[model samples]
Target: MYHLPSSPTIRVLDRFSTLPDEYADDDQLVSFWPLLSAILLRPVSTTKDVVDALEEIAHVLRQSTGPAGDYGTLSKVLNALTFIDFPPGPHPGMTLRLSRSQAACLVAHQFLTSLASPRDRSEYYDFGIWYDSEQPHPRAAEMYITAMCVFFADLPDINILEEYATRDLEMGGGVSYVLASAPARSVGNTPMSPFRVLHNDVHVTGPHSPSSMDPNGALVVAANKVIGFGKSATGEEVTLGTTPEACPAVLVTPVLTGDQVVVITGASPVLRVTGERRNVAWEIPDTRTASADFDAWRMHRAGGPLLLMDALELDEHVSELGQVPDLVPENIEREVHKATTSFMATAATTVYTPLWGCGAFCGDPAVKMCLLWLAASMASVELVLLLDARGQALADELEPFVRRWQEKTAAELRQWLGRVPRTLRGGQVLAYIDT
Candidate 1:
């Protein structure tokens, strides 16, 4: 419930109140309030052109009822909007919990109030790309908004409107956010979490895949969910990474807890709403309209949560050095340790991730895999790596490689990371470490 005209002193919309003819219909009021509130907030700032455009849209909404769509659904959406408010402020270990309906409302709120978010934000910041993009995509913004309407609508055996009303009663029915803190650095030999591998997409969901991870309460790793910690836009839901699997998962994330993905030292917890495979599969190129198959696109809480973590950027460093990047550069080993340690702090016993920081970040997958395995070992959580085609070779070599170093303490591993040859890349680096 972030009211527009943030300050009471700025009565920019007072002139509209004096005009009697504008406030005639209640339906108009229902639809008009969101637009009006946005205008008063002046999210993009008080530029004349932007103000004029918003006023024009508001004027159109005020005069016309628009469509014969379900006002009942709209009412539920509005009610959810009222209940949905971001935490008062972000501090260490702050927690905000929302039911499935409230989570949908949070997504809706992000879309409706996207104007207030920064314009220069990366595409990961909001759903504008899905709706506002000229090319014929799934229209994710409209789909999410419509999905909220359907979810909140009065239906048999389902009371979504009442879901948020009794949030305490629901057991794992909604999303929960915990700004996780970095874990204490370990020096002794910590028992390693069980390790496994899956050669598939990180976003893939089915019985054949690891979808059963929901019941175990797992936390899947999203590659680079948000960047730019301070001085970045606090609002808008952005994608995490540019990868085909990771980018579209933003639809499930709905909204970010604070400005950056890594607001805390290590991990930013996000709820990856399960059962909405079609909506999140944006790269598949949907030919149907946004409103198509509304009944099938419900958000199920079965998939559990996703841990949004950003790997250390090593592309520039690797390019400049003209040799293969090792795990020790820029305290990259410490960065990986912080993320895995943060994951260990959460309820999830397992963490599924790909070769993070390997793509545009230019991190060597072999080096990254070794570092992640070492960190996960220290955290005592099961690590299931979702490897692509290129990573299968590393996956084969990783087991024996890790087994050889399994007896080493955390301090010994760090010492070993520093001693590895800088000239070696990929499996060669792992071979050097093994030696």
Candidate 2:
């Protein structure tokens, strides 16, 4: 019911008109017109002439290519026809008719023949024809399939078509295109800064405790330096410390070593460092010790100070990170949910309702066509969900309807879903969802 532009026919005619007489012979012209017309619009009758003409046009269109070649000329003619004024209605030999505006637009496209080219010969075939071919153009076939389900009133056959379109779109780099544009932050491209550690010593006038720095002896401490900083993938830098003017650092005193581990402790403002590093390492005592007690413990007292840096680097990176772009899966899920809910609601209301009171309803083909689109869109969502176990929840609710429809269509739905026909002894219904 939706009016397609007559440009296809007009362009073909325009191309014919522009051709040299030899190429535009009456036999070829007349033969080409009907064929092109049939290709552009669905044939109204099963007559041999209409069918033969369409077959010939399709053959030629499929093989035509190159500059000013048969394909190029045909494309030009079709483009011109897009702008012609043509009436819409049930035509004598066409399944659908074009409106005046649509026709005129087709005709106008003829003038823009520069847009036509034989190089892309695959664009001519529609879904019905393309699917019937053993070797169809990947892109053209996909578009044709989607167009049939989406633009034509072919709700019953949309499931397979929709899947084919989705798969092709995914393969044609659509998902990667979206992901490549996503934004995120990384820590490999940031600045590093220094930090510090401090130690304190104490002297006790008590008895000589083994002549070494013990809890009752003198204690000596030293200061060590370290730095802390953060970075981002974009090369941005952030420094960590008490003051922006100074590097971040920690101080400790009275380093103790035992059990192959070092321990440092303090009082009031207790500071402990633990761990081992080849060049520089610091350890914190397992037990709390007052600054006074720590000051008294020493034996050739050693002060080890290690820096606390990059601890918050990962955290900073995560905080600065951006969201990823939406991909096909997410997009499809959203559309499917929206469409499915609407269709289910409508089907629930209409399938069992009586038609006696539905009077004076406009039987406009356009309205019917729109309804068909809604049905197909809904069905497409259902079919996709059927391929995954996750859809079981939805499928359970629709099982009754699905079974009924399957029975009515002679299992056409199941066949399209890649299951064997019902007549097959080993035919099995595949689980709709991934386990």
Candidate 3:
């Protein structure tokens, strides 16, 4: 058997007058809060006593008829509390018979979850609790209203209220201020996936890669003609063989007017083309072939020629070369002409690299790692083109990548969460009140 504290009805009236005007129309005052608050504030001397108090509040609220004005407030409060289903439990205390205005206050208070300090209370009121001052989302307003109710209901002292108002206005405005500044977009609506560039031709080789080429390994060449150009105007060719040097290099016969054959080898060292010199490295006064000289090479042809050399080096060469090979007379003339024409036509064009897609919810470490891997992979592709240009095909490729990553990540998360212990299992509700 349960028991309710004496003067339960008077307690309700006292608390009702203290509710904020923001919840004037809320209805849950009679329907839920009195029972909930009693349950929350009641002592746990005997479980049966608490149950009796809860049953009394529920019985009184259900049978008692409220005036029209009070009923409207109760309706609003009830509507909001209905969002959260209350588990069956015993309650004890002076069960408050909340009026319509008080119900509204309870509804508003339940929504605010972030308010930490007393100062936040005044800031919340200044924002007009229900007014849509922050993000356009309805949840934001609902949260403010709920938090205020919880704060007032839990601590009903006037001194506490004054302290909260003063602190909120002075002490960094608390969590309500943060909520007011947050964007209204739903958690799931945030942009997580990035543009991902997909290309089968390009592959990156470095210390991070599982298969790093030996420093002294023989150079591997792929024979591929420039069939198309990337968004950066860099050439794209289907790799033809393991040894492109072995095959006859196709002479790019330039048909454009004012095009001159320029033989650009490693590091863009403009080889001096004389009738006497064939595949000879000429020492130009200003041009020097060093690690730092790669930047000068990238500036030409949207870095197409430089990208090709990098691709070749990643796949084939492991060690630094002493000198760049000068092609035969016909090959040199043809390459130089192609380079000159391509540069003139598309020098101003820009290249775009695509970022990879991410899972819906990723922890900090996982997100960082995922981004790092994505960046490395995009660099490996060497295709400075907008993946969207490929449209549906590019999107299709991303699906598998995202799926594999999500599965791997989810498994790890589940394993971690599994270690947490569950306390409640039986029908008896072991409610603990922090006093």
Q: Which candidate has the top score in TM-score?
A: 1
Per-residue lDDT over 253-350 for candidate 3, one digit per residue giving the tens place of the 0 to 100 score: 12123232121111111212111111111111233122222222222201112112111111132133431211122322333233223222212222
Judged by lDDT, which candidate is best? 1
| Residues 1-435 of candidate 1: C-alpha lDDT, one tens digit per residue | 232213232222323442244544443232344334534344332223332433343244323222212223323323444322222211111112254344444444333332232333433333323322232323333334333333323111224334333542243333444545554465466654566777753333321122345443444443344432111111112122111122223333333322223211111112222222233432211221222222222222223455556565666555546666555555555556556655575666666665666665677877777677667777776677766565668888887776777666655665667788777788787788777
**lDDT per residue, candidate 2, 256-319, as tens digits?**
1110111111111111211111111112223322122211321111221111111111112222
What do the candidate models score in CA lDDT, each in turn? 0.43, 0.22, 0.24
Candidates by lDDT, descending order? 1, 3, 2
Q: Given candidate 3, what's the lDDT at residue 85? A: 30
Deviating ranges (above 4 Å) for candidate 1: 1-97, 113-115, 118-125, 133-159, 168-173, 201-210, 225-299, 318-320, 406-409
Show where candidate 2 strays beyond 4 Å: 1-5, 13-52, 59-336, 339-341, 344-347, 350-435
Measured against the true structure, the TM-scores of the candidates, in listed sequence, are 0.60, 0.19, 0.17
Candidate 1, backbone clash total: 7
Can you rank all candidates by TM-score, best first? 1, 2, 3
